[model samples]
Target chain A: MREILRLIVVLSLICGISAGALTVARLNLASRIEKQSDFYVRGPALERLFGKPAEELLGNKISLPIGDHLYPIFYLTEGSEITELAVEAPGPGGYGGDIIVMIGLDLRENRMVGMEIIQHSETPGVGSRVEKASFRKQWQGLPVDEPVELTSQGGQIDAISGATYSSKAVVNGTNHIIDLIRRHRDDIMAVIKAKGE
Target chain B: MTLKQALVHGLWEDLPPFRLVLGLCPALAVTSSAENGLGMGLAATFVLVFSNMFISVLRKVIPDKVRIGSFIVVIATLVVLVEMIMKAYFFPLSQQLGIFIPLIVVNCIILGRAEAFASRNPVLLSMADGLSVGIGFTISLAVLGSIREILGAGTWFGWQVFGASFEPFEFMVKAPGAFICLGIILGLMNAYSRMRGETFIQT
Candidate 1:
């Protein structure tokens, strides 16, 4: 009976202490982890979209709260004029996991400038073929308000053979970015305007 | 045991995966590149040292019946802590090591020391043992990683070690290569020990 009591006491104490330490560490490092993950995971994709490395592009990042989540938007400027904006978001309904994509919007031209696949866990050689430059070429200079869907549905995107779900993920991801832009236009302009001041 | 003896014991006598024949999962899984292997080693080393020290301090208070449970709590917490730190500061290396960092919680070496050595030892001595064993593991992993990286990828720590024309042995960086390389190294070490008239692999 004493042994059982002691075991309970010791194990509880150990677990309690451990939980405290872990909580502290997690709280302290949470933001930095988020930043680092973004810098590494989405950095390359942003670089590809913006025609500059993420190190430079992220320097002018402007964030706005869209619904419950704060969306970080990176912008490129030509001297004082903001030339374009880049944003990455996870598109739902992917075959495997959330298909993350970074897209650039040309502020002056009102067109979709460029796009790069930020992350995905889709099946290789088939579903993963969405990453190919040939397929990705479809997005360059597309009008920002273009309805992004597959060709069979009367949209421009042609689903890669044996990869409808993954291709749909990219299409959905692009539309998601467009919706974010349309919804947050006022908030985005306010932030950019505030920065200009 | 003296601090020096505790430290030295892990370097050669209980060297992991080689001498102790333990921690082969990470040894095999994350050793595709030198940087990856080194990152994993350092992460495990961090867990091992801290967990050993904490367990040693609490040795008497932890009842024997639930000691394993206590050890696990400490080990798992430290693993999570290390994972957070890695994600924050060593983000690239952390990404490369990936799931292996969290999996350090189940690594036998940390628990092995807690059960076999730290449980009976003084706190300082236990810490010394932890550092020594961790360093040995780091060295073993780094060496294995180097051999595989150089031959398999024709690079060492991502630096080209061969002329451009030199074709890399694609097989050397694959899963089967880890097994073959580990086997050959183990055999060679055993041969060396036999030649020196010493004991066979001792845990």
Candidate 2:
């Protein structure tokens, strides 16, 4: 009986101490970690879209709650007049797993300005080729209202000759970005208007 | 054992993944490049040294049966601390290392040292053991990473080491290449030990 008591007491004490230490460490590092992730991961992916380092884009980002994910919405501006929007979403049905796609949308033109694969685990040299400029270029200036699909699905985008799965994944990811934008258009615009002034 | 003995022990004797025959997962997975290997080794080193110290300190208080549980708690905390620190400061490397960083909690080096060495030894000696083993592991990873990076990409640490005519054997950077590289290193180390008439691998 005493042995059982000792075990429980000792285990809980250690766990409690561990929980305290981790809580303190997490609290201190959480914000800094978020910033660093943005700088290293999102910043590089969004470079072409911003035409500048994503460092300046930090001030314009707002956290938007959608479903279970809180996404950082970056509102791009030209001299304080909001010109475009940028976001990242998990595009499912990927060849390997969920492919995270970052998208930039031109509001005035109602077209996709840029798309970049932020993260993926697809087969290298094959599905990985979806990240190539030749493939990514197909998404640029694409109308957001239309359903983005592969040529086989009676749409315009051509799937890579041997990488049909990955090609389809990117098309779905592009459409996912458009779906989010259209669904949240009012809330996003309201926030933009409030921030613009 | 003397501090010098402990320090040198891990450096060459129990040299980890190679000689200690432990922690093969990270050694094989994250070591595609020198930078990644060095980063992972350092992160493990930090956890190892600190966990050894803490376990040694608490050895008396923790009961024998529940010791593994207590050790795991301590090790998990340290790993999370490492993950947080890496994400905050070494974001790019952390990103590159990805899931492996958190998996450091399961690394046997920390647990093995705690159970075998730290639990039976004093704090200072345990720390020394941890440091030496950590350093040795780091060096092994760096060497392996360098070899793979150089041959696989025709570059070392992202710097081109060969002329434009050099076409890299991309196979060296893939999964099969990892097994081959690790196997060759282990084989060579064994051969060297045999030549010296000494048993290099402790486990």
Candidate 3:
């Protein structure tokens, strides 16, 4: 029918025009948005975990190949010398959904400088307690080579009250990423060294 | 409708999520904090105003049978554009808002106005309707968000209002909390309307 044809043409034109406009907008703003998200959303967590300000650390960010994805690895320097490495690891095996954690490593001290929950979908009151300082602070200065586990499973970490599953997810996720880092420790160090030049 | 009538209607008489009883999903989901509410509201307002205006301008050209489809495409495009821009420019706010930004396409308030108001109304009146409805939605979300944040977390806009000793009622920030808070507010609004003897949803 003529009516059907007209309807199709009108809808197609509207959709085509919209898609075209969006593509233009995206092309112009993609880089700025990526920079902003890093500075705003992930910046606070990184700043808290690292003693230095986020803006100072921004210059040292480098992407390292880890598994199938390019993971962002930030170098914490002291007067041109790379003193520490902060790796943004995927801890996707969360109770609710994927959990991303930012972990700092002190290469000289050979310990975990700190860890922060960058993004998570855990239950607000229960599982979401992972955002608390008390819970996350336990990882500071922890020996990176040793297995990270909850006290219930014969490990050192204490689980949040009434949130054992979510707590376990964080512990397991950290351990999983830690194991990968340990396996590829030399390559990680090499990448950091190359970026420092 | 007159510009004055259109603007006034969105503010009180046909306030979305309350009097209009529309767009309750975002109202409940994002009102856990004042910041989230404000962010969602402003974003929605941007989409509503632009979408309404676009719909109004193209109303005559759009065939009646496929008007819904055209309206949806326009809205969907705007939502995508907003989502990309937010992710690129306002990363923190975008992250805080999460999936709610993309979900705006389905929000009844935007599409509702496009169909009921923009499709039939003149351009200026449609624009006025868009602005007023948006302001109404924003105010309602803000009130809900502030109350929830204050009671649930003892904070407003992430700043501590209560002293260190004050214990927060954790229940007020959860899903049940959203329902309870919105329900009470809706009841109060209904009571206020009863007192004024003004019927809501007057066409």
Q: Compute the TM-score of each model's chain A versus the native chain A and list the values.
A: 0.80, 0.79, 0.79
- Model 3 ranges with Cα > 4 A deviation: A1-9, A65-69, A78-81, A89-98, A108-114, A120-195, B60-69, B84-92, B146-203
- Candidate 2: misplaced stretches above 4 Å? A50-56, A65-69, A79-81, A89-101, A117-184, B199-203
DockQ leader: 1
TM-score of model number 2, chain B: 0.97
| Local error of candidate 1 at residue B5 (angstroms) | 3.5
Q: How accurate locally is residue A119 in candidate 3, as Cα lDDT from 0 to 100?
A: 74
lDDT of 1 by residue, A45-128 (tens): 776676677787667877777678767788777877777888777777677787888788998998987778877767655777
Candidate 1: lDDT over CA atoms?
0.85
Tell me how many residue pairs clash in candidate 2: 0
Please tell me which model should have the higher lDDT, number 1 or number 2: 2
Which DockQ value does candidate 2 get?
0.63
Every candidate's DockQ is 0.64, 0.63, 0.51
Judged by DockQ relative to the true structure, which candidate is superior, 2 or 3? 2
> On residues B1-203, what C-alpha lDDT tens digit does candidate 2 reach at each position?
89889989987678898888899999988889999999999999999999999999999999999899899999999999998999899888987887788789999887999999999999999999999999999999999899999999998988999999999999988878889999999889888888888854542
